[model samples]
Each structure stands twice: as structure tokens, then as C-alpha cells.
Target: MSVSTLVPAAWWARLGQARRRTFLGYLFLSPWLVGLLAFTLFPILAVFGLGFMEYGIFGRPTWVGLENYRDILTNDRLFLTTLGNTLYFVALSVPLSTVIGFLLAVALNTRLIGQTLFRTAFYVPSIVPQVAAVLLFVWLFHPQIGLINFALDLLGLEGPNWLGRPQWAKPAIVIMGLWGVGGGMIIYLAGLQSIPQHLYEAAEIDGATEMRRFLMITIPLMTPTLFYNLIIGIIGSFQVFVTAYVATQGGPLNSTLFYVLYLYRYGFEEFRLGYASALAWILFLLVLALTVVVFRSSSSWVYYESGGER
Candidate 1:
């Protein structure tokens, strides 16, 4: 057949430039696409598959179907305990972090002497290496010689064993988590700075009290940032491991046994790869569900200048 018989010359000529551009775009994106598939997508799929099997480090993977999940749900008391501990940590840490971060941002937004220094001081702790911070806290939390106990003694009050007592272990972790609130504070400060100054001026002209303006204008506009911090806090709090692993190692009657720490013990220490994969999948679903719920609720609470509620 003639070269031009199957397709019209005009149509082929018109398609050539668009096709080349598309190919070039994809060619540039190929590296990222390959990396995503190789490192991210493949591992996720492999883990999901492994979740259905029984693969200890020493043996071949055997198809166990739902056995891992059944055991976790029915037989594993530690699973429930870890899950409850994680929820407790998340519940306490997220709200406290959000509120404290937001307040710090608000306070920092105002003009003050040495404002930059104060902001930097508040934020520096958030950038410290997690292990280092945990180790430092381990000293500060010592029952007898720690700085915290020394301060309590100065106040003529006794300090309980912070990390040694099961009742205080989780709260100690929560207090440690607060040390990183400066990251969220930065986000909140950015949100606060982004709010139009004219709105506050107008509110003031309308005889709105400082509290009223803050309640109506500041909070409503900052809800999006609040929602963002809430989601991040929940996700991060659920996966708390390094602090517990380094400081407590789920110690003092397993009070600090968080979900990810438990998963790490199974996957690495215990060499139960398949069971660990199942645990990972469950955590993924739990975080996903919570994220979805937050997103759903956001429309009611999160305000945007363009759309009001979104």
C-alpha cells in the first residue's frame, strides 16, 4: 500500500507536534515514575500480599489467608493494648499540640522585643534529631536526679516517677511530643500572616473587641491550618516509635507500647515479617479512615477565603 493511503497527510502532519511534545513530557517524567513504581508502589503491593501469608524470616512464605488478621483480632491481647495506647496518645497529643502551636503562633505574630529570637527558640527544639531529644528527655525524666524533679522539689512538692510508672509513662511521652509543637507553630504563623490586615482593621472599626475579632476573624480563617495540623498530628502521633523505643522501649508495664513500635518489634525483633505486614496494613487503614473523617468534617469547620467553608 502507498505510504499515505492508510492516513490522511494533513491529519498526520497535525498530530506530529502534539505527539512529540507528549512523548517528551513523559520522557522527562519517566525517572520519577520509575522510582515511584520501584520503591513505593512495589513495596506497598508486596506488603499487602505478604499480609496474607505466614513468612517468618527463617522460612518460606506460606499462604495463611486471613489467619494473621484473625490471630491479631481474636488472640493477640498485645494488639488491642497497643492500639488503645496509640489512640490514647493520639487523642491527648493532637489536640494539645494543635492548641499550643496555634497559641504560640498567635503570640509570635504580634510585634514584640526580641520577637525573632523568641520564635527561633521556640522552633529550635522541633528541628533537633528525634533520638537526641529522646535521649536528653530520658535524663530529664529521671526519678531522682532529673531537672523536672529538681524543679518540683524547689516548689516543695514531690515528683512522681515520670517514665518509670505505667500511669505516667504515656503522659511523659505526650509531654515529649509537645516539644515539637514549634513545627506546627510555624505553619500556624504562616496562616496568620497570610490573613489580610484590612479585615482586622475593619473589625476594629466595627467596634469588635479584641477577643471578638480573634474569635470571629482569626479562628475562622485559621481553621484550614488547624485542620492541616490536626491531620498531621493524628498521623504522626499514631506512628510514635522512636521516642518510646529510645526512652521507654514500651516499658513500665507496656504503657508506651504504640502501634508502630509494636509493628517494628514484630517485623524486626521477632522476625515475623508477614504479621508485621498485616499490622502495617491495619495501621494504614486506620490512619486512612481517620484522615477521611477529618476531611469530611473539614467542610463544616475549615474556612477558605475563596469558598468560606471547605
Candidate 2:
């Protein structure tokens, strides 16, 4: 049968153009689709299945049902310990970094001498390689003959062993984490610059003080940036591994045993692939839940100029 006899001429003409564009689009996207399936999606599905089995590096996978998860929930002492450590790190580091980064951004936004130089100096630490930065801090946190302790001694005070004592180990890591706040600072600076200058001028003309202008105009406008930095900081802090791994190796009575480091021990060091997969899934759920909560709460605080309370 002829094609014109089977279909309407107008519909056939439209189909030809639409089909060509669709085909071209998918053809160009084929490489990315293939890579996603091969690399990202495949591993996630494999890990999800492995979490239910008794798999390891050398042996065939044995289906054990929920045994891996049951053990992790009930019999795993290190699981709770590492979870607590990670939460503690996040609680301390996220707020400190957000506040400090915002303040630095505000200060640097002013027209001051050597302003560019100061900004560069503060940001340099964030760009330094993670391992190298941690290694540098290890020396700085030394109990004896370290620059920090030397400065404290000059002020007629004793500096506690930062990375040595259990009480101080997590705090040391928190302080180390603060060194990279410059990344957040840059984001804040951009937000600050984008705020309209006329609003500040009107407030000044209306007899508003510096503090009032800051509280009324600056803070409300900056909330979106603050919210962004807060979310990123929380997620990054939860995944803290390289610093603790290189600096303390989850030492000082396991005070620095972050969740990712614990997962790494099981997956790579001990070769308990199934157990590690379970742990990985748990971590994924924890982070996902926290992120959802933060996003839900953000509508109350985060402000957007185009659409308020977005």
C-alpha cells in the first residue's frame, strides 16, 4: 500500500520534521547516555544488590537477605561511634564555617587598602590540595615546638594537645575544616555585590545606623547565599575523610572516625564488600534525609529578590 493512502498528508509532513529533530537529539546524547549506564547507574544498581548478599573480594556472592543490615543496626558498635563523630563534626563545622565565611565576605566587600590581596590570602588555603593542607595542619597542631602552641606560650598560656587528646581531636578537625571557608566566602561576596546599592543609600538617608542597615537590608538579601553555603557545608562535613584519614587515622580513641572513613575500612581495607555496601546505603539515606529537611525548611528563611521566600 502507498504511504499517502495509509496516513494523512499533513500528519506525515509534521512527523518527518519532528522525528528528524528527535533522532538527532538522541544521537548526540548517545555518548552521555552510554557513559551514565556504564559508569554511574550500573555501579549504583550493583551496590544496591550487593547490600543484600554476603559478597567479598575473592568469593562468589552468597545471598544472605537482610543479615548485613541486621548486623549493622544491632551488633555494630563502631557504626554508632562513627555516626556520632560525623554528626558532631557537621554540627560544629557547618555553623562556624557559614558565619565566618559570611563575615569575611562582608568585610572584604568594603573598599579598603589591599582588599584584593587580603581576599587572595584568605582564599589560597581553600585551593590547596586537601592532603597537603591536612599534613600542614598536623605539624601546626603539634603539642611541642608548633607555631600555635608557641603563640599561646607567648601569651602566657598553655595549649592543649590538639590532635592527641580525645576531647580535643574532633575540635582540632573542626578547626582544620575552617581553613577552607574561602570558597563559601566568594559565593557570599557575589551575593553581596548583587544587592542594589540604592537600598543602602535610602536607608542611610532615612537616619538608619550601620547595624540597622545590616540587619534590615543586608541580612534579608543575603539569606539565599547563606542558605546555599549552609547546605553545602553540611554535606561536605558529613563526608569528611581525607583530613581525618591522613591526620589522625580515626585515632585518639576513635574520636575522629568519620562515617566515610569507617566505610572505607570495610570496603577496601577489610574487603567486606557486602557489609560496606550496606554502610554506603545507610550513609546515602542519612545524607538524603538531611538534605530534604534543609530544603523544606529553607522556604521560611531563604529569600529571593525575584520571588521572595523561594
- Per-model TM-score, in order, reads 0.93, 0.91
Predicted model with the maximum TM-score? 1
Worst 10 residues of 1 by lDDT: 2-11
Q: Write the per-residue lDDT of candidate 2 for residues 1-310, one digit (tens) a residue.
A: 6555655778767776678578657867999999999999998888889999887899799999999999999999999999999999999999999989999999999998999999998899999999999999999999998888899999999998999999999999998889999988999999999999999999999999999999999999998888877777888889999999999999989999999999999999999999999999888889989999999998887777778733
Find the 10 residues in a row with the least total lDDT in model 2. Answer: 1-10
lDDT agreement of model 2 with the native: 0.91
Off by over 4 Å in 1: 1-15, 308-310
Per residue, candidate 1 scores C-alpha lDDT tens digits across 1-310 of 6435655777656777778568557767999999999999999999999999999889699999999999999999999999999999999999998989999999999988998999999999999999999999889989999998899999998988999999999999999989999999999999999999999999999999999999999999898888887887888888999999999999989999999999999999999999999999999999999999999998888888876633
Following a full C-alpha superposition, what root-mean-square deviation does model 2 have from the true structure? 4.9
**Clashing residue pairs for model 1:** none
Candidate 1 matches the true fold with a TM-score of: 0.93
| lDDT of model number 1 | 0.92
